[model samples]
Target: MTTFDNLLLDLDTASGILTITLNRPTKLNALNSATISDIHGAMQQALDDEQVRGIIMTGSGEKAFVAGADIAELAGLNEISGRRFAEQGQDAFALIEESTKPVIAAVNGFALGGGAELAMACHLRVASENARFGQPEVNLGLIPGYGGTQRLAQLVGKGKALEMMLTGDPIKADEALRLGLVNHVVPQAELLGFCQLLLMRILSKAPLAVGLVIDCVNAFYDPERHGYQTEANSFSRCCGSDDFREGTSAFLDKRPAAFTGN
Candidate 1:
């Protein structure tokens, strides 16, 4: 549970869960160059760590999961580097969304602009009652550069998604839940506990099977419609993972089986 310069990657082997916390709480967990680099490094670390069965992403303080990208970082970039910024971010977000294991966003408070986009990049999201979500970049004479316009509409429908982006207005947790923007909402005090509980539930199932579900769903959006091909590959890959063997063995024995993200 060592802290990186810009982020905190905590591992709780007792629960087989890794929690990635966005630091810079004083900046409202704003994403800056160093912070983004730290995130990319941390996510890659999690993906390569075998003991980590599931993951939770959150912010350092109660005030925000991440309010937005750091304006300071954005201000100095030239057009070419700016384009690379979007590309790098897309790659990081894609890795989070496409990881073999489940990644959950435990959004505690404000999740705006790139913050909201970050949550969308996770496999799923659970929010605190105090959470506020929006893609207000449009208000700043900009639009969402990190998959917001696309993923938002995919989740809540084109009309609803457009309204939010067009007006730069935010939705609270209850409304987000109603609109299917978030999976669940609970009090801020219980946010981390609830995330742990959700992962515990996930841990009860077969890891390969869970990975298959995630892969299949994401495949549907793949441009090549190679989604089905992707699904087949994933299904086959899981068949050989150690967790699959343990799962079947446990079923036959009628006992809980251990998983190691194999």
Candidate 2:
């Protein structure tokens, strides 16, 4: 159980789900440099722990998943410092995007700018009915620096992504779902439970296969790799695993397959 100054990490050992709550409710759970560092550290810890099979990221209060980055912190940035800040945040969010275990964003309210970028980093997102998402950095005479310009377009398409960024407008949860920015829209109270249930369902499958599936999908967006080739390689690797043997044997035996992630 590692401690973080800006994060509350709760691990359910039985279900192997780690719920990470951003703890700065006063700031609308905004991303500051310290918070970004905390997230990177927390994610690294979760990825290294075998007991942690999945992750759910959300904010501490009903008001926000994250309103955006801390403007006060950004107010003093120059070109060099701004680039460094963007890179740091991008690296942290990249860890979430590349996690072997599933990471889902249970967005409660505002997810704007860097906040929206953070949600986009997760593999899946379930937003509360009251959630609002945007990349409103244009209003601040800037653009999304934390992978938002890229991931937002990838998730919602260039046309819609450009509209949001250019207009500095926020979309409600239902609209976000329609645009493929979020997976589901539910009541705020049910957000965490729904995400946990979703992760549990995924965790019931063969872990090795689940991780390989993530990698194979990610390969599609990697410039240096061929998606089909990656998928084929992943399939070949899975076939050589003990979990593959058990899955087939159990299917033939007419019983539930118990996987040990082998």
Top candidate, metric TM-score: 2
Give the C-alpha miss distance for residue 152 in model 2, angstroms: 0.9
lDDT of 1 by residue, 1-262 (tens): 4457978877898877999999888999998767777878888888788778889999989999999999888778787988888878887888888897899999999999889999999988999999999998876677888789889998999999999999999999999999999999999999999999998898777777888888788888777667778778887888898988988898899988887667
Check candidate 1 and list the clashing pairs: none
The candidate that achieves the highest lDDT relative to the unseen native structure = 2
TM-score of 1: 0.91
Candidate 2: stretches off by over 4 Å: none
Compared with the true structure, all predictions reach lDDT values of: 0.88, 0.95
The true-versus-predicted C-alpha distance at residue 93 of model 2, in Å, is 0.6
Error of 2 at 140 (Å): 0.5
Q: What tens-digit string does per-residue lDDT give for candidate 2 at 124-210?
A: 999999999998999999999999989988999999999999999999998999999999999988989999999999999999999
